[model samples]
Target: MTDQYAVLGNPVTHSRSPFIHACFARQQHQRMEYRAIEAPLDGFESCVSQFLQGDGKGVNVTVPFKEQAWRLAACRTPRAELAGAVNTLWRDESGQLWGDNTDGIGLVTDLTQNVQVKLEGARILMLGAGGAVRGVIQPLLDAGCSQLFIANRTAEKAQLLVEQFAPLLPEGVLLQGGGYTSVPSDGEFDLIINGTSASLSGDLPPVNPVIVGAHTLCYDMMYSARPTAFCQWAITHQAARAVDGLGMLVEQAAEAFLCWRGVRPDTAPVISLLRQSLA
Candidate 1:
């Protein structure tokens, strides 16, 4: 029987997960089926329970449901616990729910592997202090970034996030957080990551253009067929490179696939194929 998987979210009609997973399965010659599931706003728990009770083997949780999924899973990976959210879930042979967050690894892979930007000893500037930002902080810090500055609309949230993760930082890895308005007025950073939802509203968060000099690499966690507001703004400021999060999405899905099937999917081909289709 074909193993079953799905991506669960409200307003899931626009999800490309089904298509992405199908491509992955085809490339790996795996007998599996994946679909998009629309969960009611407040009915996430019931929806997941019902799906698992049936033939569903695993799910990728998105948006508002990620935190809820984290709570529902019987066990969570270290990364998921740090993120305080679960983006991937699977049932083991013992029928126990396993949770993990691949967003951090996904972001790291896209930045270092796909974009060819070295994270080691790099100065990083991250936009936003929400769940998405929280998910990726640990991995980025682990990748040997010399310093990370998290900027958000609300200063307190950023400070709280930094404090939460500060204990985990290596001796020399600097992590600081504050409002975007508090961005240092000094030098440019090696990489700038936009983890904010500002792109969804077609708005670019207020950022210091001086922080994005010609050599800075700009990455937006939001992806679209066209350049997102953040990506466009990065370009206008003459960033060395501006990339959207499409590759991150695929890479994260690949991580989830590895966790479920114990096999890593080659993401480059899938990313290229999707880009072509979008074109």
Candidate 2:
């Protein structure tokens, strides 16, 4: 039988993982079956257990269930441990459940490879203090950015993130967090990433427009058929480039695919396919 895999979550009907993984498997000529499974909101643990007991090899957990998956895993990769969540899950020969988070690597890879936005030595401003932001912090720091300031409406929430990751801060790098109003005006930001759900609801993060310099790159972690509100804000401010997370979505799925199948698929074609479909 072909190896089986899936993505699990509540309201997973709209997930593009099946299509993304299908393209990857076909590209590498791997015999695998990937699909989406919508688990009941309160039955996440039971649902995942049922799948793994069957022919399921691994499954990607999303949204509300990621934290639940993290708790259920017998082992976790360091990234997943820091994230306090798990998006990818598998098992060892001993049947011990293992979890890892590919979100940060996904975002970093997309920005560096697909978007060609340099991360090394770059000054980055990230807007958000939620789980979505937490999953990507270590990887962003690991990318060797010179400075990363995380801003949120609740200043204390952002500061908590700063404290949590302080021990892992790289040499010659500065990491800080505060309210949006606390964003520095001393220098232009090399990159601004909107990790907030503001763009999903068509709202821009409350930050000054002066942060966008001539060469600044603005990226929204949310993607839509049209420009995200943050992307529109970037364009209106004359930022050098405005990008969405579609590439990150594809790249992350590719990372999970590699974990399951041990082969990395080319992401460029999958990203192009998703963009065209979104348009």
Worst 10 residues of 2 by lDDT: 197-206
**Tens digit per residue, CA lDDT, model 1, 1-279:** 678899999889889889899999999998999999899999998898888888788999997899999999999999999999999998889999999999999999988899999999999999999999999999999999999999999999999999999999987998999998898869999999999998888777798798988889999998888888998999999999999999999999999999988899999999998887777
RMSD of 1: 0.8
* CA-only RMSD, every prediction: 0.8, 0.9
Enumerate clash totals for all models, in the order shown.
0, 0
* Model 1 misplaced regions, further than 4 Å: none
lDDT per model, in order? Answer: 0.93, 0.93
* TM-scores for candidates 1 onward, in order: 0.98, 0.98
